[model samples]
Target: MTAAEGHGAMTAAVGSGATTVVEGRIAGTASSARVTVRGGRIHRIERLTGDAAAVIVPGLVDAQINGYEGHDVNDEHVDGGTIRRMAAALWARGVTTFLPTVITAEEERIVGSLRAVRDARALHPVLGHAVHGAHVEGPHLSAGDGARGAHDPARMRPADVAEFHRWRQAAGGIVRIVTVAPEVAGAVEYIRQVSLECLVALGHSSANAAEALAGADAGARLSTHLGNGVARTLPRHPNLVWEQLADPRLSAGFIADGHHLDAAAFGAMVRAKGVDRSLLVSDAVALASAGRPPGDYRTPVGGEVTLHEGRRLTLRGSELLAGAVKTLDECLSWAVAAAGIPLADAVRMASENPAALLGLTTRGRLQSGAAADLTVYDDEPSIGRTPANVTIVAGTCVHRGPSDAGLAELGEIPEELR
Candidate 1:
């Protein structure tokens, strides 16, 4: 029986307009809800009286997820099976839809990972796989060692539209987001080229205000991991981060995992960019499982990075910091309480904001005719603790709490199972 049915039906009648009533704490308000979902879209929302005073929020849309659940997308050995498995794992983590981010790797490896994601998407067109698109972090980026971060300096270079076109084809037309350094030669034109077809992001570069704005003018809509993938000691004024955050035309994405940026920095960026233009991405690596154990994490371009502590990891760049440990949910929490962002606004950053930034049509909002993606969480209004328990992708439960079992698995082909 479903969780609600398992508790025995205690019907609380509402307007006949209701189809499926979801009871939970609404935003930061007192626990209440009678959210109706029909035809895989939220039909209506109303306050309801119920005992399980939980909260219902929109499911998260992560534009960047390099790896999770013991599977790294950058790893050369990643296959269709691994991609499907990873997609399933993310769904359980409250991600309704996500871009399978393949970070800097050899050209061949990037091509392979893109193909794997494409195959997985094709195999499961429904939200089961939840592969809305693919995010290519890049080999075509800055050459400066510091700017390149964990990306192999050798692989990093100026933009080449021909190479990107080849990679896009190999991705089975599933490539939607591509990160490029506007400072690189030919990158401006290349941004226009790729942005014509996909969402281009400015990342791993040392572009100043003029160059960064040029990228935005060239149709670069998002900045990948805003504060994490750039030079360490940027000039105090008019750097890429400041420019991107200040430009109203451009949208910014954050790792939100406090490790990516301190509370102060994170709050400043949010202030500059505004919640409407800011998005939460879990630039999570392959070892994002519980128990912050140190492990070797392989990247698409670089060989591996050793997770050393909660915030530190050894990567290709001698002094570059690696990916973080926190989930997108945790990131949202920090943004809300610690960063002093409103709960509704923080939810937008984790959901609607990313969807708008990435140009996703029917996601991010819990409104009628939108994709039925939802994140159910336990909320402590007093302490402002909101932890996600279940993630529903396309109206089907993907991840559940320890209390929930027998939840449906996504992208699992019965024929392939023994």
Candidate 2:
């Protein structure tokens, strides 16, 4: 069989030299181009004259990930080793950078988990580069039943800036994003203060439209999985959903996985928020066991959960969603093919836009001088049994995939990477 048929052993050269070359059509444009990478950055890009079926796009940046491939971030005993493994699992699936999310756990667990993530980054350069920071998604959320979703309502509490400082101190300033409920006591002030150092977001709330806008005015610039985190039933008119979409100051993060939103609903939201203001987030939890059969399972994060026939995860006895199960790359494909989103826009939502939201100017982009984080789809991007091509994290060829089985076969990670 030829090299191309082998899924890129000879087709793509990773670590080829201080400088490497890749030629393809940039996503969202008709122009085919050649991009040169030197010393972990894009050195140059030039238009190429050829028939190139390959599509080169920015690397995917997932804003919220609780865990992946059975590594649970919120597990009671989570440590640096868990984070190290999760980063590698994400890399194989084409997620170059992700925010390891910690939800409404106890105060001790939250800080301990953040410290572990910081230690993981300190101990491994690859993980340090791959993990942007920790996203604290709870403890500041509403305690109300329906609005709290799968989170333990008993663990919910009013927003406290003192505890927030402890989180920053523990993570070595790695707490980059925080999600809160505007209606909660002290939340607006918390947003006002934390916004100076972090990306303040609003989520898991029972806030009315005016209250939601107040949070946005208080420097809450992003919405966490906007359409999904609120109460199951809300006033038909003037709800947080409509208010969030209409507000120009806030960028909305969306989960384009099939179970989250159908094509028409996703299309409407994208149009409402405008393609430029919308971003994609997986909101993934640790359930991606490659080839692990779908069935019932007990988990520490969301007790008594079931991984269903079609990759949707839910509480064992209820219709409520436990958490997302799809990877960011797969979410992008569904947005384009099933959700009626334009491929270019979907790519941006999955990559560039999310990076920009978090203030990472050089990440999730395709340009000269940007970090050489990239994904090359063999043809046009699509989801199948394989990743379909090569993925580079900081110019290091990390994934050349046929299946996720590569993780076990890659042998022991060198000490530095460990």
Candidate 3:
């Protein structure tokens, strides 16, 4: 097949220098363009043409994603096939890189998931190549039944550094973020130790302002799904959630699916934390891609993950989300249309801020010398109209929809995989 048939987009040497000039808007900016790839890296960007059919933005980076396309990373049987499918599904959603988040579960299950991720890397090197790393969301978190969400009560233990170390080793050093509750015993030290190698985030906690601040001081730099994974109600002032948001040193992620936070509270965060420090997480589940039917949805926890129905349906679950029903791109759309955030700012929340939290300099931006991880949206200055028309990773086109895949699924599998 021809290169155009394979990628839906044509790649030809442009200009006198054998350069590939991708002319399109950067984010929502109506007329800016980016030119990339020289010596196997992004060379430069310039505004060369009028607004193209799509806006070119960095491919999204979601720091917290539990599952996708019917695969839960925390499930008892998180096999390599599941991880591969999850990665493929995520890429189809315009995610060039993400942290395959594993939430609270049994120790053995956690190890199994980590090893599955490791084995996926071994079997499909493209997955590892796209994966920013793993985000181990907690068994060493809050013990409060309400606060810990769907975390298995039996496995809820004190912050165990050795266990985290073991998980890191088992995953072939893919642990990039660990979210814990500062209120847990020895949580501060665990945060300190883990932050030395990977990012530590505070979440699923009953901690007050002081405890939250202590975690921040101990090197906790992120708050996972800031308001979703906490108690039902918090103290009027200086609450842990409020404290984490008010602190300038900590960057917080939020589930912008509109179910996690109300319009007012979500807007308040945007105003309080500013776009630079506020990240957007899909917090989606395995059911996100194919979509879930009206029935009981099972979670790692005992009961099923349910969604209420009405003019609006709220996700019903303890702490872990109902299921992956939203993509990071969709979350960005909600942040813009629902919360009234700027299109560019919402894009940054979905990409740059999350990348910063993960300490991933290579995967977030469209700057010269960075990886050409880009997404082209079909619609315009309004984010709601922008659909992911094309996705490029490392200057290579991985997805092109009907214009490329022709109804069949497309994959980025490398020849030497496994």
Candidate 4:
């Protein structure tokens, strides 16, 4: 669907006058609840029966997404239309809100992409509501092998406040998260400065325990994809992995796509961070939803990449992963299956924790006065076994799966989903 069509569909759904009430067993609670939504905000939540078969949870929130459905977020050609398509695709996957993450690139490319996203938010209603903000992931990361991942080493550089100001201006101050290498020159001060405006996350680094702690002291509060962007092997003592895992002040984001981390490692990290401090991120790329066959394919960056079995993308002929390719729902399923986390806790990691991390109070909860963003599914914990039956954004049914006959009877598919 076109951008205008997507916006029009979302407007029609949310602008309707009637109230919407959904009944299901609420996540993180024992009883089933009747959630009342009116004028796009939750009007009331009344506990009724405790025997509902379906599960209801707050809509998933993805803090980091590079691209999806064959549209690259960092591509210079990216525009408002691309943003709309991405938003619609995410909505179908049960994401009510997300950040279009822009990774390390040249100054002009980064600024242009940021401006495009800002403009998309202003021009498209669905995208405007779904895109909470922009996530800037690099240009200030480590250049060493494994640490750099697929980011271009030639464009990598130390932190610069002036450059950051330009990016903020380009994005109209919508940048909510910035990831940096703690070991970069002037990075600690950069974190201190930017933390005043947005969250500062450490990633793509080879920092030791001391350096990581220094970054934390200077206001870095998060580790971006903790175990992935580091060397394959490290010294046994005082390494970046152990350091970040042990730091109480830093919450870590993990890509629970099953391939990014081993099951044992994923379980250990979750245990270390505990349920309250850990968050889930989908660092997915365009190829994630492109429907392309598994094999080698060239990309704008990362050169030639290979899509392996289970949709894992990696640098051609190399052991390094290009980026994640799973939706947050799939990641949640992996968390439940691989790490043995409770389904409720996995949902929280995909929703509440990231919302709290971003200071978004209204979007992540299913309480009175909060936005009516929610997902309905069957009792199965595996995401694929029980895909979102219905996804509501701001009290409007935007996506109704084949099994959601009730929702489909209410209305046709939104143009955004088409």
- Quote each prediction's TM-score: 0.87, 0.92, 0.87, 0.92
Q: For candidate 4, which ten residues in a row score worst on lDDT?
A: 1-10
Candidate 1 residue pairs in clash (backbone atoms < 3 Å): 25-54, 74-300, 92-399, 104-301, 105-300, 105-301
Higher-TM-score candidate among 3 and 4?
4
User: Global lDDT of each model?
Assistant: 0.71, 0.80, 0.72, 0.81
Q: After superposition, how far is residue 80 of candidate 3 from its true place, in Å?
A: 2.4
lDDT of 3 at 382: 33
Model 1 residue 209 CA deviation (Å) reads: 2.3
Give the per-residue Cα lDDT of candidate 1 at 142: 78
Off by over 4 Å in 4: 1-16, 28-30, 381-387, 412-418
lDDT of 1 by residue, 1-418 (tens): 1122212222222212223345565565554655566656776665445544456778778888887777877776887777777777766566777888887766888899888887776665553337787898887777675677777777676788998889877776788899998988899999998888888999988788799999999989889888877877789887888888888888889877666788899989888888778888988777777676766656543456777666455674344666665667777877876778888888788888888766776788866677777766655342113335555566554555643322222322233310
At residue 166, candidate 1 shows an lDDT of 94
lDDT of 4 at 416: 53
Which 10 consecutive positions of candidate 3 have the poorest summed lDDT? 1-10
User: For model 4, how many clashes?
Assistant: 0
Taking all chains together, the TM-score of candidate 2 against the true structure is 0.92
lDDT of 1: 0.71
